[model samples]
Target: MTQSDFAAPSRYFVDESGTTGDLSRAGAGLDFKQQPVFALAAVGVDDEQGLADRLAQIRTRRFPQAAELKSSKGHATTTVVSELLDAIDALGGGILLEVMDKRFTLAATMINTLVMRPVSPDDHKPSALWFRMQLAEQLHDTAPVEVYDAFIQACRNPGEASLKAAFRAVLQLVPPETPRDSPAGAIRLFTLDSLKDYRKAGVSKPEVQRRFLPLPDLGHTGKEVWILPHLSAFTNLYARINKLRDGRLAEVHIVHDDQPYVAEILRSSKQAVEDLAADNKVMALARVDYRFVETGELTFTASTSSPGVQAADLIAGFAMRHTRDALAGSRPSLESLKVFHRLANTLDGAPGFGMNLMLSNRDVLRCGLLPSQVPPMQPS
Candidate 1:
């Protein structure tokens, strides 16, 4: 083991709001539309026992009967959140929260798979990400219902056949009626043409075809494979942990709430980061955040057993509720907004380190968050 391994590593506890599920499922009851946002929060504490004691004290004072505290139980009121935030600050801990708009993420995923990814591994470039944001927005708005329906179906029964059908649907898209000369029409046409060309190239490359499809066992597992905002959010949070420390020598050990279904996938993702960090060729193209995470793997514990995870639950609940309200075009309460500002202040002005938002530009604009706090899109 390295010398740094002997040093006490910073510990973080993680919990998530908006359970990960296939967003394509639609019916009279639509979770994606109702929830709209997925949120993950991690709380780092230098003094675990102190944090735990504080949390226990808060519960005793607030809810004398409850065995455990949970935000999902409608217990993360403004007063409770304020106290939790205070305890976090008092214990020299910081919180990181990641929120994503499910619909916007779905649109971006399609563009990422069909448009941005290169046919050959060697042809990938950072510049390809420079302009896809606008295309994702255009595709999300102008796409035919058939296209979305097909993609949803593919997510349900993911395979080579389903992916091919969905990609073909995209390639053969006849955009909805719009004035040909109008700016909107021009964008739709441009998006359609771009997707057709890129997806065509993607389909022809047999070696990388599965990259365009879901995980081989997605249907059987019923786990979320496509449009994984939770995974993206967690990766960003992990990166933020390294960034906040500004040194790779200090190890980071995070204990996340036990998620049986996604545990293996998260470990695999961590291994990919470990592998990519060591590969000179890949690291040359990857961003700075990809490096400096010293921890080799994650540990999981139930929220009930971990104070840090419980603290994270409160923050995630606040973040999810406020963002959902903003997305639905409803004004948030002044108290809620105050707690948000307090949460924002915890980062000490580093934008993406404390809070990350993965919403479309339109959703962001209406979300009532400050312009400076919105995270700039990072290259994939």
Candidate 2:
């Protein structure tokens, strides 16, 4: 059963953090200080057994209770979290990371549906950035930042009423033309009507200043989340597929953390890639057709059986900490988040290879956590 006895395949171990299935409820259940970002992370290994050995060693020495490796403790202190991340980094495999900005997502999703404005020369599906830019243009330049700052401050260790009032304020800034059944619409209507209600009352109390939308109560709880770890894997693999093809090695086994619904997402992703491969889809990054994926069998196994998955969990914590800090308006420090700025397996000296920052410019600004080495947004 020793790792030295067997050769490992080219595979990725993936895990996720900050997932609240329903997008709107991202931070709905967690305490207000918690991050609302969703991130899926993967650690790719050419030698899986090495990673397993390292993890086993880390657990026995650093994580006494975790030696059994049942499940991640959901949160680890900076020291424990760093030890795990360092172990993964020492393995030398490239890391793949993806972050989802919920605030931007919430606003963007609503604006896309509610606003009828068309782009120049054509009517196409509005992009998240486009929606934000549109709203930013309408604002007094400082409104978005002021509103964003208010929400950030309000959500910090917020109580139920605080959340209601805070989100109601958020709704006011993006209210739709007419009230609708959707939460986005409701928040929008509330966001707008609350302003009206407050103005009519002619009160400037702190409560009135909150611009809260009235709801039945403030103590509702929990929501679901979908973390398509495979999507991160897809991006990771796509970046390397051309190289794999060039090397005449088109096979890769995916190793993922034993999360719910993972197999289905992987299978679905596999099929989609297969279909695209069958059609000879070209990847712009590699400037080659997806022949690599077509020729390869992307067989994946759950992480309960693989040590690589545990290493990927290290990345989950790294992401969790960075996300929380990023939300609080600070970047991850190398002393605290050693792996936050580390870039391995890069292409053309890019800050990330399989690693991707999923947040938009607007949210990044809100968090005040832009790293010096972060890559510029790719031209889509």
Q: What is the C-alpha lDDT of each candidate?
A: 0.66, 0.47
Off by over 4 Å in 1: 1-9, 24-33, 118-130, 141-145, 155-208, 214-224, 247-250, 281-288, 371-380
Task: Tell me how candidate 2 scores on lDDT.
Answer: 0.47
Candidate 1 local Cα displacement, residue 200, angstroms: 6.4
Count steric clashes of candidate 1: 0
TM-score of 2: 0.56
| Model 1 agreement with the true structure over 98-130: per-residue lDDT tens digits | 777776676666665544544554433444443
Residue 331 lDDT (model 2): 61
**TM-scores for every predicted model:** 0.80, 0.56
RMSD to true structure for each model, in Å:
5.4, 11.7
Single out the weakest 10-residue window by summed lDDT for candidate 1: 1-10
Question: Looking at model 2, which ten-residue stretch has the lowest summed lDDT?
Answer: 213-222
Q: Give the alpha carbon lDDT tens digit for every residue of 1-380 in model 2.
A: 12223222356666767654433233433332355666666666677777777767666776677643433564344555556656655555556566655554433332322222223323332343343344433332223544544443343323444444544555566545644664345445534554465556544455543333211111114222222223433444444443433524456565666554444555555566557656756333332234444344445556677777666666665666566676667765556544454422222222223345545555544444352233222211
Clashes of each: 0, 9
